[model samples]
Each structure stands twice: as structure tokens, then as C-alpha cells.
Target: MADGAPAAAATDETALRRDLAAAYRLIALEGMDDGIYTHISARLPEGPDGQKRFLLNPFGLRFDEVTASSLVTVDESGAVIDDPHGAGVNAAGFTIHSAVHMARHDAACVLHTHTVAGVAVSSVEEGLLPLNQWSAQFHGQLAYHDYEGIALDLGERERLIADLGAKNVMILRNHGMLTCGRSVAEAVKLTLNLERSCQAQIGALGMGLTPRPLSDEIAAHTAAQYQKGYDRIEVDGRPDPEWAALLRRLETAAPGYDA
Candidate 1:
């Protein structure tokens, strides 16, 4: 039994571990991770202690190289409560994730990535543009935070939260991107969409062509469609069984993600 296992468990912790691990690999495949720069974390189930913490990737491990047992558990205060595998986690990662987790209850899983497109879009003067379907989905829903040098300062948490507001997607100006979801799958999906959106935008921009922008009404409608679409398909109605299948595939390919 794992260190956090209970005598009679209903939920399978191993499944969660696998899901998280699969997410890491998927992010790597999508080119969303930047050489161990980003982090993904899932909130653990509530325990007797009421801490109800999370598990995050170990520091220095490349996204593709991360395994389930390699994750480290920590409390909201950024302190490691369990380090059985001795997989060191980054203090900066903890600082960002713990702040969001502590401030927002809906943020069950927080994902951050530093891809070329994401960083490029973040640094753009206008931020994300609603020129494409992928970009339009984030219209009126994206938050922006100014870069504050490496995210190591504890004081940045409050401002980060303030900038995030109620949005699910955030662009760290001159930095990268952040997305929060009720589950690891949803978070991963959001990040994937965001990355693709940025990539598409950048590709379009490079052509030296002025792209057509969606009207405010259309952008709003599209954004609502995405929010409701994800809720109905990915979140509530099991509309995305493929994501579950992908998780299984990940287990076969990289078996120890959920450990």
C-alpha cells in the first residue's frame, strides 16, 4: 500500500496517478513543456487531516521522463509532507501552484507551460487575438499577468491570483501560459487548446497577412460554446471518452504515472 492509502478505499488513487503521468507525457508530446520549466499539479482527495493537498512533478525531471511515483506531495503552504521517492520538487513550482490552490477551490488541477508560441503570444502587445476558432474560444476569458522575474517571490501569489480573477486561462505577459481545470484531464485539454491557438496565431501572423477578427458577438458566442462544450463533453457528460482512452494508452506506454 502507498503511504497515503486507507484501510477501505473507494476511489482508486492509482488511476489518478496514471492520469497525471499521462498528462505530463501528453504535454511533452505537444511541445508545451520547456525543458522542465512548467508544472502540473492535481489536488489530492481530502484526508483525515483536512489538508487535502496535491501531487506535482519533481523538479529537474523532463516532462516526458516523469513517472507516477516520481511526483511529490505537498501541502498548501508549499511544504512537502511526503518525499518517499526523494524526487525533489521546485520551490518556484510550489510557490505558484500552492498560491492558486489555496486561493481558488475550483482549481483542482493547475498547469503551467512555456512553449515558444505561448511565450511569443504572451509577449505580444495585443495578447491573444480572436482571429481563429481556437483563438476565439479564449476570447473575453483570458487573464494576463505581468512578468515578475522567475515567480520565486512569495508576495507574487496575491497579485497572480488577482490577475487570474475568475478566468480559466491566463497569459503571463512576457512569460508563458497557465490554465486551471476541475480535473487533470480538463486542465491538460485546456493547455493543449491554448498552445494550438497560440501556434495557429503565430503561424498566421508570420504569413504577413492581416487575419480577419471575429466580431464581438461571435467571439462571445464562441467562447461560451467552448466553455459549455468542455463542460458537456469533457466534464459532465463524458463526451470525451477518447481522453480516457488516451490515459490508458499512456499507462501502457509509461506505466508508473499514477504511482
Candidate 2:
């Protein structure tokens, strides 16, 4: 967070910071951002003392303005440590992210967005219809959590976790979308696909015509394919080509996240 501040597992934390910052910028660049409202967060590897923590964008900074060094480290209790920016964090961000980070240890990064289409889909009773390939990937993997208001209550974390059980993505009813991943790249990719799928659904529904949804069997098969990995061109286990391309896009569009 600050110069000379001690970082737990510096190498791993540094990499996560860059990746998380890049996700924030990409979201903003793609017009998926909601001012400084939504948050993208990453879980930090354990330190020597085995303290559980995660990185979240400091409150008040727009996603496009986020840099690797500007991210804040939040402990398991949602308190910011090594507060370099001293910006604290949005209460809703802490509540939502803390819920997932605590309940889902496997989620290395979590992305939340309030895009118009996303909110529209969330408000729908059907919730993220599996009408397209982009949406099919989450056919049965998407969860739904009823909005209990502004998410300021820490007590709501339990209900949130219960609603999101064993799912990688969720639609907060009357709110927006949330996605978590084993990596930042995965999280961003899922969010991108989710947003596209939402937009497509909205467009289809706006036509006042009955839309043909993907068959349940097809949706299941597509979700399986995604689980097997798609567009993954890995060489010696380095960054996947899809992720590399995304980073390059960020570099050209909104650089300086690695700072």
C-alpha cells in the first residue's frame, strides 16, 4: 500500500495486485464500471503468521484510476492494513467481498458490477436465462441472492454465503451481478461474458417477442465445455493467450496499473 511497507509473500502479492488492478481498469475501460461503486478484489496468499487477507480497491478512486500500489489490503475482518492510501473502503464493498472471501477460500478474485443490463437481468424473475453461448457457461452455475438492502450489515454475510453456495457467479436480485474466479483473468473473463450475456438477453426481451432459450441439455453441455477450458493456449503453464491479450488491451487503453 505504501512505500517501504512490508508485503506478505511479496512476489505472490505483487502479482495478484497487478492482476487485480488490471481487472479494475479493464472493467472501467469496457464501460462496466459504476462510478466508484462496484469493486474487484483478490485474496492474498497466506503470510508467515497465516493471516487471511485480500486486496480491494481503495474507496473514492474510480476503477480506471486504480494502480497495483493503490490497492488496499483487507484482513479477514474487512479492516484495511498497511493503509498507505488511507482511503478505507466502501462499506458495501467490504460486506460483499468479505462474505465471498471468507466463505469461498478457492476464490482468488471476486468481481462485482452494476451495469444497466446486469441489473435488468437481476431484476428479472427468470435470472440470467441460458439463451446464448455466453450465458450458457453459467447455466446451472449461477446463484441468486435476494437483496437485503445496501449490504451494510455484516450479519447478512451468512445469508449471502448460503445463497452463493458452490457457485462461481451470482445475480443479486434487484441489484447486479457478481463473479469470482480462481484467478484475476478468470474472474474478468467471466464478468465480461456475463455482461455480454445480460445485454443480449435485454436486447432480445426488449423486442416484445418470445425468445427461444437454449435447451437444458445444450446448456449443460456448454457449461461442461467451459469447465474443460476454452481458448486456452498455454505454453509451459504461463499466462493463457486470452489473459495475455486482455492485459495488452489494458496497456493500450488504460496503462499504469502495474505501478
Candidate 3:
């Protein structure tokens, strides 16, 4: 039984690594990455003592360079658990990701990005405007955190969680955007949607025309309509049809992530 438990854990972690690696490649493919700045993290199985650990990219690797075996494991104290040869996880990046992982147990995957559109929208006073279906999906689910320079201090984690509250998406004021989910595919989906929302908002507002925004009631309805159906839907390697199709696309477009 003990041996079987270890083997099963290994198998589960292998699947997670593959999914996370694939997410990195997909993000890079979509031009959502910011060199090596932003981060995507996955919470690992807890220890008997309930110690938390996470899998994060090595500090210097570009998103496209990430592979399943190249990820590094780290604990809350910024200690690297595995891969002594790793470039080490980014200390500043850990501050943002650890805050979400520790507070929101349901957020198994946390994705952060510093895309131009995301940052542009974050800088605006209105936040994400529900201008379209993609934008409406985040209507009430989006939160905001006033930027506080670089996220190098562990002390900031408290305010980060407080700002995020129960929402799965956030705009780091003057910074970038964040999205979290119970599965890697779910997180990827949220990131893609949120990024699209920001892009649309910027593109629309960039034009001088005063576009009509959705009514609050309608936006709320659409938010639920768009995302609530897929809540934690992926299981046992069977993602929803959308995520399954994405993985298939990766097989052809970005093949080496699973390696």
C-alpha cells in the first residue's frame, strides 16, 4: 500500500507537470508572456504536516523553454525542494503566487501575466469594461489590487489576498492581471478569456467612439452564463472539450512541453 501510494502520487504529479508546461507554451504562443517576468504556478500535494509546496518555472527560462521536467518545486519559505541544479524559483514571483495558493485552497493553478493590453486596462479607472461576451465573463468576478512596486516582500501577501477576496481574477493596478483556477486547464481558460477581455476593452476604448457598456445586471448574468458552467469540470485527465482541443492543438503547434 505504501509503495502504491508513492507511485500514484508520482503519476499524478507527472500529469500536472505536463499540463503546466503545456500552459506555458500556449501562453507564449498566444503572445501573453512577458519575457521571464510573469509566472504560472501549481500547488502540490500537501505533506503529512500540511506543509505547502508549489511547482514554478525556473527564474530565467522563457515560457517557450519550459518543459515538464524543467519545473522547480519550492515551499513557502522560498526554499527549493527539488532540482538542486535548477536556476531557482523567482523570489519576487513567489510573493504573488504564494499569496493566492495559501489563501485560496481551491486555486490549484495561479497564472499571472504582464501583457501590454492587460497592463493598459489595469491602468484605466474603469477596470475591465463588460463590452463584449469575453469582457462580460469577468464582470463581477474581477478584483483589483493597488500596485505596491515590486512584489519582493512576503509581508505583502496579506494585502494581496485581501485584495483578491473570493474572486478568481484580479487587476494589479498599474501592473498586470491575474487568474486562478481549480485546474490548469481552467486557469488557462480564465487567462485566455481575461486577456481577450482586456484586449477588447483597450481596442474599443482606444478608438475615440464612446462605446455603450453593458448594464450591471446584464453583465452579472453573462458572467455566470460564461464561466460558472465549467467550474472545476476537468477530472482524471479528461478536460472539457475546449481544453481537450487545446491540448490537441498543442500536440501539433507546441509539441515539446510534455517532454
How many collisions between residues are there in candidate 2? Answer: 0
lDDT of model 2 at residue 92? 66
Clashes of each: 4, 0, 0
Candidate 2 lDDT over 1-259, as tens digits, reads: 6665565357778888899999999998999999987898899877557888788889999999999998988787777775567898775667888889888987888899999999999997989898889999998899999989988888888998999998989999999999988888888989999999999999988999999999999999999898777334221344577888999988888878889
- lDDT computed for candidate 3: 0.88
Best by lDDT: 3
Residue 240 displacement in candidate 1 (angstroms): 2.5
- Sorted by lDDT (best first), the order is 3, 2, 1
Off by over 4 Å in 2: 1-8, 230-239
lDDT score for candidate 2 against the true structure: 0.86
- Model 2: per-residue Cα lDDT at residue 102: 82
TM-score (all chains, Cα) for each model: 0.90, 0.92, 0.94
Model 3: lowest-lDDT 10 consecutive positions: 230-239
Scored by lDDT, model 1 comes in at 0.83
